[model samples]
Target: MIVAEKKPIEEIIDQVKDFQKLLIAGCNECVTVCEAGGKKEVGILASALRMYFMNEGKKVEIDEVTLERQCDHEYLEEIRDRIDKYDAVLSLACGVGVQFMAEKYFSTPVFPGVNTCFMGAAEERGVWSERCQACGQCILGETAGICPISRCAKRLLNGPCGGSTKGKCEISKDLDCAWQLILDRLKELDRLDDYEKIMPIKDWSTERAGGPRKVVREDVRL
Candidate 1:
């Protein structure tokens, strides 16, 4: 899932301080699972903002709302009727969600409440680790399910570079060498022979090199 972290409260306040009426919008998806932005977090942020305004001797109207998803057009429409009631909206969703919301409500200002990190997985409670870069080209089929592109410090296609020592990456002892993991997994699957076949240079054109991407599935289109 897309991982995100909360931005500093001071920064958030800075963005919406000029507006007397503010809406704190949260998401019920990835940010919810990560504890950064959700219904619970929306309430917490609302309370904190109210306290700040109260302490400043200023009266502010802040509303809290958590949508099923800010990225989807259907969910975003839920707020259309009352959206203009607020001076601005503080979106506590992923960057994608924030942009989507802003696009839908082009006239209203939408500020990000969280810093989008990356596509990652939760290793444990409160601990999320980066797993994929979404390079557009998936090479996991040949790498024993270990992604060298995302985990490797060097992003080497065929590697366990000389920098690796004792199955650890040169960048950090705690970091396992991605290629080493692949080699071990391959050995277990008795597919070590596949390692001898060198992969061709990757076609990066399919990735960000081509700029923003879009998927068009004719069969799925209504």
Candidate 2:
């Protein structure tokens, strides 16, 4: 899932302070699971903004709403009827969601309330770790299940960098070496021979280097 963290309240306050009416929008998808931008979080933010404005001797009208997903046009259209009611919208969804909303409501000022982190998994309660960088070229088949592109500090493709010490990364002892993890997994699977095979240089054009990407599945098209 896409992981995100809430932006500082001070930063958010600075963005919407001049507006008399504001809308705090949340998402019920990835942000909800990450405990960053959800229905509960929207209410909390709305309350905080209201209290701040009240304390400043200003009257601010704030509304809270959570969409099933801000990334989807169907969910975003739900607010079309009343979008003009607000001076600005504070979106608590990922960057993609915020951008989508901005594009959908071009006249409205859309502000991001959370910083999109990365595509990752929940390691434990309240702890999320990066798992994939969406590099477009997947090599997990030969590297066991561990991803060298995302897990490696240097994004090494073939083997561990010389900087690695023991099983830990050279950048930080707290970090595990991606190559080490890959080797261990391959050994367990009795596919260590795969490691000896050299991987060709990755074609990065398939990634962001080629600019924004889109998929066209003719079978799924309406």
Error of 2 at 53 (Å): 0.6
| Candidate 1 lDDT | 0.94
Q: Give the TM-score of candidate 1.
A: 0.97
Residue pairs in collision within model 2:
none
After TM-score superposition, the amount by which residue 120's alpha carbon in candidate 1 deviates from its true location, in angstroms, is 0.9
Per-model CA lDDT versus the true structure: 0.94, 0.96
- Stretches of candidate 1 off by over 4 Å are none
Clashes of each: 0, 0
